[model samples]
Target: MSILDDLRDRGLIQQVTDEEGLEKHLNEDRVALYCGFDPTADSLHIGHLFPALMLKRFQEAGHRPIALVGGGTGMIGDPSGRNEERSLNEENVVKEWSNNIKDQLSKLIDFDDAKNGAVVVNNYDWLSQMSVIDLLRDVGKHFSVNYMLAKESVEARIEHGISFTEFTYMLLQSLDFLRLYQKENCTLQIGGSDQWGNITAGLELIRRSSQEGESAKAFGLTVPLVTKADGQKFGKTASGAIWLDEKKTSPYEFYQFWINTDDRDVIKFLKSFTFLPLEEISELEKSNTEHPEKREAHRKLAEEMTQMVHGKASLDQAVRISQALFNGDVKSLSKDEVALGFKDVPSFDLEESEKPLIDLLVEAKISSSKRQAREDIGNGAIYINDERQTDLQYNLDDKDKIDGAFTIIRRGKKKYFLIRH
Candidate 1:
């Protein structure tokens, strides 16, 4: 199947400037395309996966993909999808973030292929060199104020107020497309739905500036904005945004995010995120319908996503931690796994590890008082490392510790506490 057909099957295509022409262009030769990502933060969030993965998809299809890091445009923040002005970051901070984003993109796109190897470009390299006169006379003159104001990005911000800096963002982005098309032989530009206007503007700039004029084969495509079935935002949990960097969002947390996917959205996510064959996905869809309780599809989604982002070792660790917690076999987990598993659980640091069980319970706030602690112990409601410890006189010892660093305590079936030495 053509790449466009595959993307359509996965529901990735939202808007294409000219579908027939693009398909022809793609089939005629190994087409070059690009997707721009602005470095607005130190880490790229899950929201970035669409375009980044889109680049990967094209690369796997034997096409060249350019991953553009907006080191320059990031300073001027795109007004697309915002109701207010963005606070600008310092140049050094933006540059640092740009580098970090480039590193992350390197993980997603293979840059070593001899034929269709990916390329990472920073707009700052060229955008910084262009003077204001060149920007205005050479590029800005092509876009009129009336045309700019008519765009949804600028139109929406007119009532709330928009600065001149933001008003000219489309022009800057147009410059990026023109520069890349000239330097890299790029013929396609893709982004989220919000970037439709900017993408088209770039196409316009390419066509107008080309010696071939309107016959320049430049095209634009945008993917749909991902939304949750529950109407909540994608890539967000109670903790915060799901970051691509492991330091920001651990592999365990990332695994859990996909594992907990809503039944209504799991198949859609699998189609969009995983490279699983469509036929296999259809079977998974059948399993989802016939045996929703088994959650086979959910597990597959989690496994694929975890392994893709964090590698096999991290995926195994995440699965091991998950299984241990589910089976109430906390002792089987390693020290690092235990730390990752109980990261959010209530924890207490022990000054001494030799206290009586009841005293320790009271000190750790697991029980209201010594009397309650004794009652809990006598009632078989207390456990140490998943083992029932009913003895009222039981003393905290090294045996209770996992790897001699931490102990897992349970007051009842669901409430758990971590004790650190």
Candidate 2:
């Protein structure tokens, strides 16, 4: 199937400027497509994954992909999906973030393919060098004030107020498309649905800037904005946004995020996020319908996402931590696994090497009082490292520590605490 057909089957295509023409363009020759990612933060979040993966999809289909880091436009901030203006970051800070995002994109797109290797470009490289006179005379002349104000991005903020810096963001982005077309021979620009206006505007700039009798063979496509069945936003949990950087969101946490996908959304997500074959996904979908309790689809989704983002070793560690927690076999987990698994659990630091279980429970606030601690122990309600310790006078020693660093304590079935030494 053509790449466009594949994307349509996965529900990835929300809008295309000219569907028939774009499909013909994809089939005619080796097409080079581009997607822009603004470095709004040091690391891209899950929200940025769709476009990044779109670039990967095109690359896998034997097309060249250009990952554009909007170091210049990032400083100006795209007003596409906001009701209020974005705070501008320092130029140096934006430059640093641009590099960081470039590194992350390197992981998602293969840059060593020799024939169709991906390229990363920073828009700041050109946008930074253009003087005001040149910008106004060369590029700015193509856009009119009425045309800029009519765009949804600018129109939405008319009442609330948008700065001149943000108002000209579309022009900057259009300049990116035009520049890429000239330098890289790029013919397509893709982004989220909110970018429909800007994407088409870039097409306009390309067409208008073309030499006499020259046709600008450019197209714009956008993927739909992801939404959850429950009406809550995608990629957000109680903890916060799921970040691509492992330091911001650990592999274990990231795995758990996909593992807990709602039944209604699992199949749709499998289609959207994974490169798994349609046949395999169909079988998984059937399994999901026949035996939802098995959660086979959920596990597969988690495995695919975690491995893709964090690598196989991290995926395995995440699965190990997950299984250990689910089976109440915390002792089987390694020291690092324990730390990751119990990261959100209540924790207390122990200065002493050992302490009586009763006193430890009281001090750690696991139990309200010494009497309650003894009662909990006697009733077999307290556990140390997933092992039942009914002895009232049992003392936690170095042996109780997992890897001589942490002790996992459970007061009952689900409530857990971490003791750090």
Candidate 3:
């Protein structure tokens, strides 16, 4: 099947500006496409993964992909569907985020000069230099205020009030595309469906800025916004954003995130996220019918995505940690491993000296009250490092430490704890 055919089969095509035209363009040698990523945060979260995945798909299909970081546009946050204006981050903060975002994006797309190698660009380079008059006379005249205001992004903010900084966001963003189109010969832009307005704006800028009858034209495609079956935003847990960076989120937590994908969302996610062959995925799905409890499909999805994002070693580490936790073998992990493995697991820290097991248990809020903690220990519901602690007087001492470190506690069958050394 052709590239567009594959994209269609995989359900990646959300809304392309002109499907026939775009397919025709891609049939040519190495279609140059670009996607914009706003460096609004220090690390690219799972929310950013859709575009990156799309870019990866395009490159694998023998197209050049360019990633644009919204260094300049990030300063004036895109007011797309925001109920309130975003707090503008400082220049230094945005710059640092832009660089860090670049690093994160680098991990997702290959930057080598082979395999339709991806190129990275920052909007700040061009947007910072354009004079107001230069922008208005040269690019702004092509778009009417009426057309801009008609967009849902702008119209939604009309009642809430949008700042001049935010209102001009499209202009800055459009310039990124125009600049990349000029510098990299990029012809297609892709992003989340919310970026349709911005992408179309960039296309208009490109169509207008070229010389009279200049044969320069481009297209826009957007992926659907991922939402949970539960109607919650994707990429969010109770703890917050699932970052690509390990420092912000552990591989263990990341692994759990994918493994926890609801039954309704798993197949859709596999299609959107993984580069797995369609037939193989279909067969995997078929297994669900034959053996429901295996959760084999979910396991494969979790492993593939975890390894892709966190590398094999991290996935292995996470899996090993998973095994250790499942078998109630807390002794199998060292202090550092325990920390990383259970970072999201419920826990409380205390000095080994001041570590009254009751106080620690009460403080972790694992137990409802100090008396309850004592009672639970007496009831044989309490475990310290997987060993049932029958004594209420069990003051945690260094002698009971794991590698001179923690005492894992459990108040019930589900809850877990880690005490510090």
Candidate 4:
């Protein structure tokens, strides 16, 4: 199957400009495509996974992918897909974030291209050099205020308020495309569905900037906003984003996130996020129908993606930690391992003065009341660092330390608690 066809079969193509024309363009050898990511956060979250993975796919399909960082546009804050205008970030902050994300992108794409290799560009190099007059007279003339205002990106905020800086974001994005097209012949742009308006603006700028009849029309493609069947956004836990950086999100936390994927969204997620072959995914789906407790589908989904984005070592460690948690083996863990493994478990603090262990247990949310805490201990429902503590008189000691940092507490089989030192 063609790469585009494969993407469609996997439900990656939500919207595209002229499917036949795009197919023709893609059928040609070595098409150059790009997708821009903003430096809104220091680390990329799961939401950025689709576009990054798409870029990798394009490279593997004998195309070049320019993974551009929005060092320029991020500062302006495009209001696309947002309810309100974003808070503008400091230049230094954006630059630092942009650099960090660049390092992260290196993990996924091949940047050392002699031919059809990936490229990373920081848009700041061009945008920073433009004076107000050069911007207004040169690039701004191609875009009409009516056309700009009507775009869903800007128009959606008309009822509220849209800042001029944010409204001009499309122009900045278009300039980046024009610059890329002129410098590198990039012919396709991909992003999330919210970027449809901005993508078209860039395409139009390319058409206008280049000579007519010689007009090199570019294509725009987007993925649907990742969502759950219950109509909530995906890739977020109560703690916030599931980030790509290990420091921001431990491997154990990342594994647990996918292992806990809502049953309603698992198959869809397998299709969307994973690069596994259709036949293989279908086979796993079949197996899941028979024995879901095996969680075969979730396992493959987590394994392939976590390995692709993180590394083989990380995926292995995540699986090992998961097994340790499931087995409730304390001796199998070290101090750092304990920290990374129980990173997401609810944690509480203790003072030296607390007495009876029951009061402390109730305060740590292990039990509803002191009486229940005592009852739980009597019945052997509580554990410290995976060891069952049946005695109500047992108090924490330095010997119980995991890495001299914290203690893992368990209420039942699945629920966990952490007491930090």
Cα RMSD for candidates in order: 1.3, 1.3, 2.4, 2.5
Write one digit per residue (lDDT tens) for candidate 4, span 318-405.
Answer: 8888788788776577777777877767998765533456776888888999889989999988887788889888777776667677
Candidate 2 lDDT tens digits, 328-406: 7877878888999988999999999979999999999999999999999999999999999999879999999888789
lDDT of each residue in 168-212, candidate 1, tens digit only:
999999999999999999999999999999999999899888887
Best by lDDT: 1
> Once superposed on the true structure, which residue ranges of model 3 sit more than 4 Å away at CA?
114-117, 212-215, 345-374, 391-399
lDDT of 3 at 103: 87
Better of 1 and 3 by TM-score: 1
Residue 394 in candidate 1 has what lDDT? 97
As a TM-score, model 4 comes out at: 0.92
TM-score of 2: 0.97
Residue pairs in candidate 4 whose N, alpha carbon or C atoms collide under 3 angstroms: 335-403
Candidate 3 residue lDDT tens string, 234-266: 999999989998999989899989988888888
True lDDT of residue 238, candidate 4:
89
- How many residue-pair clashes does candidate 1 contain? 0
* Model 2: worst 10 consecutive residues (lDDT sum): 208-217
Worst 10 residues of 4 by lDDT: 349-358
The TM-score that candidate 3 achieves is: 0.93
Q: Can you give the lDDT of residue 214 in candidate 4?
A: 37
